[model samples]
Target: MSVFPSPPSSPPSDRRRYAIVGLGSRRELYQDGIEKVHHRWSALVAVCDSNPGRIELARRRSTQNGAPVPLGYLAADFARMLRECRPEVVIVTTSDASHHGYLVQAMEAGCDVITEKPMTTGAAPCRQILDTCRRTGRRCRVAFNYRYSPPRSQVKDLLMSGEIGDVLSVDFHWLLNTHHGADYFRRWHSHKRNSGGLLVHKSTHHFDLVNWWLGAVPVSVAATGKREFYTPAMARRMGLSGPHERCLTCPEKNRCGFHLDLAASPDLKSLYLDHEAHDGYWRDRCVFRADIDIEDTLNALVTYNTGATLSYSLNAFNAWEGYTVAFNGTKGRIEHSVVESNYVNGREAVQGGVAPGGVKIRVVPLRSAGFDVEPWSAEGDHGGGDRLMLEDIFLPEPAPDKYLRAADERAGACSVLVGIAANRSLESGARVQVADLVGDLPVPAYAPAGARGESVPMPERAR
Candidate 1:
């Protein structure tokens, strides 16, 4: 069966021109959005990638979407692609460390840009993106799709409505189950240099949620991290002799529960396994390799500019995937949790989709009874945030969003800086101030609310 649904017969001529660099699995959302969903408003003009196989795959996908085959370019020819294609906007779905280069180059070429999260891996590249965006006056948007999820958006609305009054602190814990979490160890993400460990690569999502939910910038971070689960010792403990190079050649593939067969899925085979000679990028390396430097367990304390402190933790090898967050406010408390289904990336499955009846929200008032608040529901990936976010990104005139979920480079810096600070703290064992990393970063615009020092209604005496 074809992966993409049949697209519109003919797209309009006035559609915005878009080119996407980095033909990874993450690029599918934008590519399909341009060709299938918002074809009337957006046209994909070019695709670029380091691997020629993936570039061809993207062109094939365009044919599947019933759209014109976009021009394909190798990574080395990116500048030439920009000059030739003249894309109005460049969508960057590159690796965490390479995002800044593509973003800056695109902006310099007089094109706006949209990037997948973490924006960049380190502080230096982040500053470069910010400086270039400011100098060129080109819009640089960070695709923080988590903020657009219906249930998550509802949380912002509740906070804005001052239902729990001024938030004083936040407690957030995120869990990545073995199925999805283990996948990270099998890819380039296992290296700190490429991904800045899970703190910047994975925790960026959690930290950004706190920043957006509180409507404040993080000021400082103190953290500790360790690799306990996905380690060489764990391989022996699981009765494997030791870690091998890749899963395809691993001798204990039958014994190792974490073994991933790229050939089992057609998408993975075509996208990665079949193209091994082009870039030699393995889709299924052993999880218990000794060279893996990223941590599996992480904990951090973040202080916000609003004087709200956040206690956050991320465990990558949990039994289930999801998160639980609580807001401590001057008047009351709000708690939200969701259990997400497990799915490996690149496969034909929803990434971060909520399980059946997995969302729960509750409010507890001081000296009063607590009640369960119904969650806002949605369908599709990431609790339907991807769909809504695509509309906002590709649509010429999307509706005014009161939540202000559309994030820019400023918001991207605010979120990743927290994780970057945490990484430094892990190495130094001292609190790292965000200002020290990136001085005087402008705060992202947020919806106005009465919570920041406004007077709260006095509660009645307890019964």
Candidate 2:
């Protein structure tokens, strides 16, 4: 481990100051944006993490931008950072459980907030954060990066133009192969309390995209979830014996490629292995243990505020990553997908696919309609929305795609609200209403059949 830098102030900047919390996998994504985008729009003023080394690592990484590194503060406490650093923006990159805590504090301190997904584990905390933002009159943005991808954006544009007509319903399915999905089982995400299960944590992205595309709000949801695969008993049934320190040390190490070698990667080692002194939790563990509450597979039926319907499913133990989504509209239909041959490890993804990486789009016109599917444009990753979304977030001035591309807090909340409802539905074995979760956050415009492509004005309460 390298010696961490101490708090040092950079020259004054006109841009807003920001701080980061939770130095984990998601932190890296924000860091990517900070290095690439924050230079102009914002400045990383401070970083906070429970672990000393990660806090140190984040501080150093924030400063050393490969040029004249800007100096910033380092603190283990977010509250202290707020008082000392006085950042205008608070980036909550912490674990799922800690999201609401930092979010409330930041908003109450009169700072804008941008946090990673699931909003908060459940509606209880989500309500608190929402209330805080409302009372304090500060903005809260959820990082649903998937919505900004291009191919998906095209689908969004198609729906908005009524080219696909009124989006009556949607069918969405995603498969996370063993290489990709199993990674969740290895980390803190295995617990529902920590990651809000995949439905809230991961599906929040999928749900948000669908809401944006349909231009409607989720009204009600009924769901079911299960952990049919990856358990200690399953491992035992597979004839694996106990007490192995790690996968690489296991007798069946050769047979299990899903095994995580925690010590091999410097990033993993510095983040988890080296921090055992501060926290005893082990990062590498079998996914099937009894304490792992999150589901491996889940299914849901959703109804939108405009009465649009959606059937959704997600599976985590497939052979590859990516997802498939089909939108059924009154006039036409659009389907999109991106399937990987294998997982990308180190620098290279094991080769196996005919199509390009990321989601692809196919729009089909109804009989007597003008559009053609064969001549349609193709998109890459999240349907080519990633780069475009980055541009929307990072660019100093809005571009043509920016207005069509960005999703506001209401859009973000409405999307995750469905997952929050679904999680409740799964728990109660009954239908859960979206309003019960998010209390009627405003939604985007909706068009009835044959209506012109005009923005359906939102009511004051809806807004």
- Say which candidate scores most in lDDT: 1
lDDT of 2 by residue, 1-463 (tens): 2223444456357775777777765575566566655566666666777677666666666556632233233334567678876888788877787888888898998898887776777777877876787789998877776666445556666776776666778999988888768767766788887888899888988888777677666789999998877666766676666324455446676666557777887766776777767766577776555667788899999997667899999998886677888887766688877675554222122322324434456777665434434322324333344445556665677576533446545655777778888989998999998787767465443323334344533323422
lDDT string for model 1 (110-198, tens) is 99999999899999998999999899999999999999899999999999888888899999999999999999999989998888899
Superposed model 2: Cα runs more than 4 Å off: 1-9, 67-76, 242-251, 341-359, 368-387, 400-404, 444-463
Q: Model 2 misses residue 47 by how many Å?
A: 0.3
lDDT of 1: 0.90
**TM-score per model over all chains:** 0.96, 0.85
What C-alpha lDDT does candidate 2 achieve relative to the native structure?
A: 0.69
Candidate 2, 426: how far from true, in Å?
Answer: 1.5
| Sliding window of 10 residues with minimal summed lDDT for model 1 | 1-10
